[model samples]
Target: MSAHVPQICVMGVSAAGKSTVGIALAETLAVPFVDADSLHLESNRTKMAAGTPLTDDDRWPWLDAVGAEYAQAGASGLVMACSALKRVYRDRIRAAAPGVVFVHLGGPRELLLERATARTDHFMPSSLLDSQLDTLEPLGDDELGVAVTVDRTPAMLVSEIIERLRA
Candidate 1:
């Protein structure tokens, strides 16, 4: 790995195991972990809890806050889990914290749905999965990130990410 540890954003639709993998990755990298959902405005959380999807306006401030958190981490480095579902959203985050790398977690819809259904206490309900998947734009070829399949255990996923980063 480089002398400077990369600030990583674990991104995907809800239930793609971003938080699970991100926490393990942060442990491995010895960096702090933040969940963007925890930073959401109460209004956004209310809407999501009611099964309504947020518009771009609703997301801008939240994304900016997430980006700012990354910028704040600076050389200390951070691993954040966010449903950065669009290219524009990722671009917005990149604009705030340049050189941020995204780890895109992906899996089949059935698996995602199963995970979503199995979760408890999360603000994002299973009903929002389709909307999230609909909005997701896969990482571009030029994007600074790796797409990892989410069919394995969180430890294995973290190991894969660590190996890739080290290489």
Candidate 2:
């Protein structure tokens, strides 16, 4: 691991293991971990719970909040799990925390749906998986990030992320 603590965003569609991998990665990196879903307004959560997808307007404030968290972390660094499903959203966060690096967790639709369905605690419904997937824009070549398949265990994924980030 590098001597410098990293500010990282674990991004993906719902149930793509962003939170799981993010938590482990933070622990390994000795930084704080936050799930960006916690930053959502109750109205947004209610909308998602009702199987409604959020419009861009509904997300702007929430994304700004997530970005603020990253900005607040400063040099201490932070690991955040956020469904930054679009390049614009990622850009918004980057504007706030310029050094933030995203780690995109990607997987097949079947696996994503299965995991989304299995999770009973989240507000986001499995019905919204397709919408999130539809909105997702993979990390571009110009982006400071890496894309990793989520077929492996969280430990393996975190290790890979650590290695990639280090390199």
Candidate 3:
């Protein structure tokens, strides 16, 4: 495991504000924030844009790459936005980047879908909401992570994380 105690993963369903909040969290922590979506291949982007939900295999490499970055981060921890919907997906990332911590941002399906619907130019379409939900695992008490509700202001969420990390 890496020695960094608080390397954070701002994870959630699409449109759940992973990218938006990850950037803020990273800035607050004085670390680099990465948008994992930028790492997506054009093919995957095309597939999702066409209303297709990606299988686990489609996401494996991307997760691996993100994990690699985490491992190489050394003391300068990073925050990243990734829809780590399943336990397996999270496991793979943690496996590569030991000591990685996740901040699971979750919200009501209706709220998420509404945001997705309002978005433009994003690769993911609102139609895949159901598929995303099918794979989502709410962070459990024993999950070795923080589960924060995304139903509040970003500042509130960031404050929650900042306090958690400090504690």
Candidate 4:
């Protein structure tokens, strides 16, 4: 693995506040912030906008792009928001950027649904929340990261993640 401890990925299902917390966390760490959703291929975006969940085939290329972005950032490090909802997805990214750490932002399905429903401009429709939740695979015990509940304020969550990383 590379020695890029702070090349962090803020991961979660939709409405888990990956963007909000990821941007804040990047600012806190004084690193560049990238939203993986922005890296999505137009085709994937179209599928998502059309109320269709993407297959792994649709995601592989996008995940590769995301991984490349992280690897390209190099030792300066970066904070990125990605819906790395499965272990395989995280593994794919780790394959590209060996030392990327993942911060799994986890919460109840109801909360996620509420948050997704409240959003208007995002390409991911609220209806996909169930599929996202169903697909989520919690961080394994050996994963190089921490899992924080999103029930608290972003500041609190950021503080907790910082403390964990320091350990």
Query: Candidate 1's residue-wise lDDT over 1-167, tens digit each?
Result: 46697799999999999888999999988999999999999999999999999999999999999999999999999999998999999999999998789999999999999999999978889999999999999999998888999999999999888788678
Q: Rank the candidates by TM-score, best first.
A: 2, 1, 4, 3
User: Against the hidden true structure, what lDDT does model 4 obtain?
Assistant: 0.92
Compose the digit string of candidate 2's lDDT tens values, residues 1-167: 35677899999999999999999999998999999999999999999999999999999999999989999999899999999999999999988988889999999999999999999998899999999999999999999989999999999999898888788
Candidate 3 stretches greater than 4 Å from native: 1-5
Query: Per-residue alpha-carbon lDDT of model 3 for 127-147, expressed as tens digits?
Result: 898898888987666566687
Q: Which model scores highest in lDDT? A: 2
List the candidates' TM-scores in order.
0.97, 0.97, 0.92, 0.96
Residue pairs in steric clash, candidate 4?
none
Better of 2 and 3 by lDDT: 2
Candidates 2 and 4 compared by lDDT, better number: 2
Could you give candidate 4's per-residue lDDT for residues 11-90 as a string of tens digits? 99999999999999999889999999999999899999999999999999999998999889989989999999999999
lDDT score of residue 140 within candidate 3: 61
Candidate 3, residue 161: CA error in Å? Answer: 1.7
Instruction: Report the candidate with higher TM-score, 3 versus 4.
Output: 4
